[model samples]
Target: MKRIPLLLASLLLLAACTAPAPSTASTPAETPAAPVETPADPANAGDVHMLTNRYDGGQYTTCLVPSGSYCVSKIDYAAATAHSMCQIPGCQHTTSDCPVLSAGHLLVDGDTLWYPYIVHSDSEYAYALAAYTDDITPPAHPLFAVTHYQTDLVYSVNVLAADEEYLYFVGNSSYAFGGAGPNGAEAYLFSAEKSTGLQAQRLRLDTLLPGQNAYWTLSAAEGRSLYLQYSLFSDNTSGVYRYDLDTRQCSPLPQLTQNADTLGTPLCSPQVVYDLQQGSITAVDVPTGQSTLLTDTFPTGDSYTYAAASFRDGWVLSYSLWKEQDAFTHQFFRAPDGTLTELPQQMYCDARGTTPVNILDIQNGLVFLQYAYDTVPVSSYDYEGNPYTYDTYLPVYGIIPLQDLLAGSQNYRKLTFD
Candidate 1:
């Protein structure tokens, strides 16, 4: 596993799409995944603006300069949008929640950024969204892109695929909602397009164990099929599956391992209750149902806490954390030939009371986050005097690739929503 450095790349302009400029904060800086080229459509032009709010305050938020600027918001939601911070010359103080996207999801569809605003309500699990925009404008209201499928379902989804063609997500259909029991839960796929909007399409399962389920990961392989790891929904068996959109079919790959969760958490938990080591990377052939175990030689001690893993370009990079006593660390690794290459630097602090960090999007060697800096349990300081704290959505960072991090690898799987 090769390490991926968590360093911010210098901002550069490419065509109309530019990298997210650096912010003023010393802690986790705000960085956009990649500059999205806005379509000439007027409806989407306003969608390119970047904005964020302070959870400590009301619904008030600050916007970044449309051209290219950085801003920081206070806990009270008092945001200061400047070309740069007062301290850093040629730098701006802008505010954005674009960097702190929740774990395992990215919203960039082509150039248009689909911001996911997770909705919490009685009968709806809607994600309020804003379209793509260029700068910070007042009344920074996001467009309400609601999901038509409403349920009290217990499904966990991470953004699996996003491109100009469609938006693909993997989640479980709950047995609780119009279900028989726990086994009633099944994996599903949802899609959306710039013209067609959002659509729900249930994937055909080769085996329905009712209790068997799998979460969508960022794992990419060749062909037009998306790879996944599935386990018995209950406390016993485990399996993996691959769904082919071209054929609208699915098949079981293999069972890497299973150590049932005692606490009954989602498929993304970092702990193990049954088998000390369960759930390694498994590749499946969508058409033939063949599969291979990528990493069987598990490491000792603890595995870094990463929300997910993906084979982008030619490398397998997993977002992980390694716990050393009281410190919680986060990093990315290049898993080539079963060997895990740890990134050169730690992406972010995985300490107690630290803000929730998520890798929202990765494109052209840059990572985007829907970051939120909240109250953590740890007390530490960065090089700057400011405590290592996430008061709120401060700024977004547009990272650049330090090295060919995805070197020595294979291609990722592909599928079409049309």
Candidate 2:
């Protein structure tokens, strides 16, 4: 029996948020332009960002609270508070009995909150889809289920994106008895229609791009089209492709394709697809393929790599990875008018500047962050008697008002079960 290596799983997870861009372009040292006002289309913004999704006027996310269990929580931007979606009284929130806890990896679409859950039987395992709503109680049974024969296999099924008609997901199944060929695992893209009952249709990526072993991540969805980022394992090449749901056709975006190898995974808004390339943030118009330089003045040196970006409320948030320092460094917020404002480094680090913080998502005038807390140092030695010391920190989720973040305030409020 063989399983998907943890490193590969981790790389897939990282691809969901960021992509590494290695280039020969020289580093630039110039201050970013001052803040100005630019308008963005609210209708064009997609439903996905980091681990949270926006629907109607609310923001929803699944997070691990202090209770040692994952719980789905809703953020109230007006009140600047986050509380578990579960309303059951006296719930410890540490068991599947909690409705919100059970429905993991939530995707808020329209009036429904959809999630994927697994069912175990004596002979087979069922990967299923379930929905939750504010106006009604949680359903006891899943609306759809896909059965697998290998009961002991290791697998992951996640709901990636949803439109009015169908929900799209990626499923990876690791065979326990060598059924998945040499890789020992298989990846698939599936779609389940909202109106269809108990059905999951596997999509053919091979039909779009032939003879390539690749995995996909849904970067953005608009109307009848889906923007997918794919990495081909055969040649170690990566790029973005537009897949039309209506025509079942796929085409490469030439503007993005030109620098595909250097252009990392994109942060897509309705009107633009932004990528980090050659130490600068570049935006490509979705409709016209017109390229625009967002900012090139982000502090780029030999030690830093422009890591990732997220767009929300007309603001583009980006960060750089510090190679030598082993931390996420040089965080910035690019206003609509192209004004680049640097978030103080202290906000992401402790007094001694050891802990690393990740900017998870920005939405609804709020900034979601994940960092380690209550850390303790752990030291050990290798087989060659080499000394090594590392800190063990518990990861925690928190939020900061977007206005406060722009104004250089570190008023972080932890999303706790209490």
Candidate 3:
């Protein structure tokens, strides 16, 4: 563990003692591993940041821990009076205390906080958004007061995309008497202006693709159009449907070919396709829908299952063509121009890489990555007097400029902005 000064440790303990004790459920059993300690007041840490979410006592609390020895509290309206102090060194003295927030996803636009919330009294979901411009401070006067707006379409709504003009979400409801009957789901597209509260319209996915499976990933395409990636059967030949905004129609893009019949966006657009059946890639034109074949990067006859296609200055695709399931030496490809380019040390293992892999979200030339790790148990305990095993699952969230990824660094500094 990272060494902490005796005085700092005492202060942290005192602060923690004064705060409410947050309880957690027992975790799974696992062998213990040494805790990785980071330096305190770490300034040179890269854009990699860490966020910890602990669901304890029926409430969810998230902490934003920046590089070594820095932790800040996140506050929301629900946690108006909840006081959060840094458990790490240096943070308590320098950074502003975060306010406790209600349970939901926290959206940040340069300190302007927006959370999708449901008005329990009316049981309708609304966007609880707060924007702070210029001089006004936060946790005091959330520029816009809490206003209740309703979209009389569905009950449980999960917002998929939101902008100044429109908000898109998926609403699921069961058919008929709310029994164990078949469920009906719709993709709700809502538009809002300053004068009108919210205008909503629903599009049924089943009606669009009659027999297609549940519509899962809903992403905004160019204006008024949505791209949906959904699974069909247990095997190949799924579909990526484009929902037109003007005509209110869903159609599978004309050029996407099926292999083994499984289909997914290996990378978002203007890129090559990973043919599952042929085990190769084919480039496609978004405008014309014309497709051209490309050479296979992996050894011929090697069935390399594609993982993800990340957008960078170029396309950064993740492919796991393992020689065998659960094998140590797996291959990775970083094809920039739909052409094959090899990377050293392709294989990744749990002891080295991490479980559940990682995702690359490249935004504004900044590359943000989220990864998960399994930590062994230091101790076990009983839950409400019932015996249970315990272990820790740590999730690491960080960001780096796209340049860093292109440069390929062996070392990175941690980022902490409480």
Candidate 4:
């Protein structure tokens, strides 16, 4: 199924008006899918600040900045504030030139950019998960693309996420959809290394869910184990499970918000869990599994239950107050010291209505928003004159230093791309 109705997006954002909080970690918080998603409010449709002429845009994300990082987040702005990333004398980072069409996932580790590339052979398109480093010549690479792994189901597969240790991709039929059993549905895990293109054993996990099957989303990896979550609750569990890359075993983590843990805004680490079931955020001792409640009154408001969001560097917890579909309306981060820092709140308008600002990556003092893009198609050609076409292109996406954004300086923290 061409999942994301818009340009084949994957993993639609999930939020609940209010999911019942379990009394403790063992309780399930399978959020009832928000009422049939309504078209974004017409009022939100009127905002042109983000899609205006002066700004550039790229697919925003909440995942880690390079790869194998955090999930995504969003915010709302009242007006289109002027902000640009740190630019050098001749640095080029705008998404204006659509070099190669992506088969829908990208990962940046250290200096190499890894992506599943789409190739047009005759009339059919094939895909390869490939990598390119800054060491290579620009505008043109050595091969049609560097291949790490080749697969026939490019269109059928979407990357759930990536991190330092592994490159992850999920396809409906690649293996995750191979079959089913009484224990649960079977999903596949295909991992690759970042430094060298090495393939790991393909793991099939029967994450028991109520429905047909369950797929794993890489939440975090540490020491010798990797953490995974289900697109839907897996193996009748809500929190992240520890998956040993070597043993392929799965175990539950009770301290993390297993009741409300989600891929959209997952903990992504073993250190913290946003368990609303206990109505508080807690810090976990990974080795001991002991948790200390960090904050009982996580930022909330009158019409919001203050859904617990993701954690940043295991030191801050992100929360968005949701009235209905307003996942990014108001946000605040809680630190280990029990201090709260609220970022600037702004709202944007589209032809539909006012909507929240799209926040991509949040960590270590930086916040990347899928903001600002030129009014052009994200299409371009490579050195070989191979052409590509994206439904929409991003001319600029804004990156704001968390401190400046909080201080109300509208300048992008500054960056340059080759």
lDDT for each of the candidates? 0.33, 0.51, 0.34, 0.39
1-418: candidate 1 lDDT, tens digit per residue: 1111111111100011001111210111112212222222122222111112212211112223332332222111112121211223333333332332111122334445444434444554544444534453111454433433654333322233543444555434444134344444444444444455534543423224444333333233234554444433333343344555454455544333444332122232121222125534444333344544544333323453323344232233343344555544334544335555544432233343443334333434443332332222445788877777453323332222324333522121111010
lDDT of 3 by residue, 1-418 (tens): 1111111111111100000011211111122221212112212222211111212111112333332222223432222222233233333322323222213333342223333333333443333323322322122333222222432233222233443434444432222112222223222333222123233433444421222222233433444455543332223333345655445566665344343233334213333556665666565544345665544554334445654354433444445545755532232334455554332222134556533324334445554444334354545556567656665444454444555545553232332343
Which runs in model 1 stand beyond 4 Å of their true positions? 1-106, 121-123, 128-130, 135-149, 154-158, 162-164, 174-183, 202-222, 235-237, 255-418
Least lDDT summed over 10 consecutive residues: which range in candidate 2? 24-33
Instruction: List CA RMSD, all candidates.
Output: 16.9, 11.6, 17.4, 14.5
Please state the error at residue 203 of candidate 4 in Å: 2.8
Give the range where candidate 3 is weakest over 10 consecutive residues by summed lDDT.
11-20
Report how far off residue 100 is in candidate 4 (Å): 3.7
Give stretches of model 3 more than 4 Å off.
1-114, 117-164, 174-196, 202-213, 223-253, 256-261, 266-273, 282-295, 300-303, 321-326, 329-359, 362-367, 370-379, 382-408
lDDT of 2 by residue, 1-418 (tens): 1111111123243322121122311111122211212112223333422223655334666666656556667765445456677778877677656766634445666667665556655654666666765532245656666656643223334535665555666544433122333443334445555665423433433311223244456656666666655444444444555665554556666445433344444334322333343456666544346666767765555555554454565444455565654765556777777777877735323434643356667767777776445565779998999999987555566777778877877678875554
TM-score of each: 0.42, 0.67, 0.52, 0.51
Pick by TM-score: which candidate is best? 2
What lDDT tens digits, residue by residue, belong to model 4 across residues 1-418? Answer: 0111112244322220011123211222122212222111122222111010111223222222221112221111212222122122332322322332122333334344443444444444444444533332112322222221343222222333444445544332333344334444434455445445344434443334333443454544455555555433323334445555444455665544343432224423344455444446665544345757667765534443433444352233455565666555445555556667665645343332333345554555566564443334457887899998754423344577667766755576433321
Of 2 and 4, the candidate ahead on TM-score is 2
Q: Could you give me the TM-score of model 1 versus the true structure?
A: 0.42
